[model samples]
Target: MSDEELSSYLPHQGDRIRLRVHVRKEEETPRTKKNKLLTVLQEKLEAARKKKTTSKEEHNLEDMRNPHRPFGNRNAAKQNRMIEIGWIHKSNQRSTQIRKNKGGGTRKTEIPRHATKVEIIQQAIGLFFPNGLSSKGPLTNFNFDLWDFADREIDANVTVADMYERTKLPILRFYLATSQKTNDIGNTTDA
Candidate 1:
């Protein structure tokens, strides 16, 4: 008997026939097109940027028009400024151990404009020396000093507001000078 004749008598006779399938392509909407989508997104971003800038400008204008208004009183706002403090040896070399123990890199503190160098040092001590200073510790007989970017030591009496007035920068960067101690062998070491 021929295969076809035998297949027609089998229980799975439909297996002998091959089926053809067709797939339909989905239609693209106006916004689904790449160029159209990008254009729409760009327009939205531009509009948002313009709105934000205009609102800021309008707020500034309002503040200027009524400087004494309690609703927008600048004096009532906190005049805190950001300060970055890092530890460095008196030789100006960065201390890896100190940096690693101090959570790596410079520590930032937000202080009011009227804060003094002494206050900043206290804050720095809290950040780097959690247990506070001790006579038995490495910082014994050592006092930290604040140094500016120019490597000049800042006076303890100077206020942050004065520094800001001179530099006109919102954030100030400074280094805490590590004290050097001489061992019995006459070798200098960083405390």
Candidate 2:
């Protein structure tokens, strides 16, 4: 009779369709590696400055301290060299990556860098686990073998189901268990 009334014909056929969805998007501050590192360094410098009783005096830490402590020869040039000036020196060990090979031996491996001047790995998120969701390795203290092996065939967004479809690991535990949620339905009126 009324517009709000549900009719039998309308119930059989779909009267109207309503789409509902909750969309969440996060806008991360796009920070460069150097920018983040420099900010940290600057903070450290500022804190050091604040702690010092001296007025506007930059702390020459190693310079003032008696320099002839170490076992190295007391050459004046090397004395100045101890105080690292502008840049930090990376290890010549070539990329901090080492792996064991077959035949009971070890081999050196290096991942390609984005640039000539080694960009500080400010964000190693996708670099390590592209899946966004961390694997069991990181949770435990176990070493992640993802980097050592070649890239996976599946996309970063691929889940357990996708992996199961591709290869092994069909981890289907809850079937009917998840069909309808089991709950002890309680109400204030019943009480």
Per-residue lDDT over 62-121 for candidate 2, one digit per residue giving the tens place of the 0 to 100 score: 545756565433432231111100111112222232212211112222222221111111
Give one digit per residue, the lDDT tens place, for model 1 in 103-143.
43488888887888788877776766656553224555455
Clash pairs, model 1 backbone: none
Candidate 2 wrongly placed segments (more than 4 Å): 1-29, 54-191
For TM-score, the strongest prediction is 1
Report the poorest 10 consecutive residues by lDDT, candidate 1: 18-27
Candidates' RMSD to native: 14.8, 36.7
| Cα TM-score per model | 0.51, 0.14
Candidate 1: where are CA atoms >4 Å away?
1-67, 70-77, 91-98, 101-104, 133-137, 181-191
Q: Considering summed lDDT, which 10 consecutive residues are worst modelled in model 2?
A: 172-181
lDDT values for all models: 0.66, 0.28
Q: What clash pairs does model 2 have?
A: none
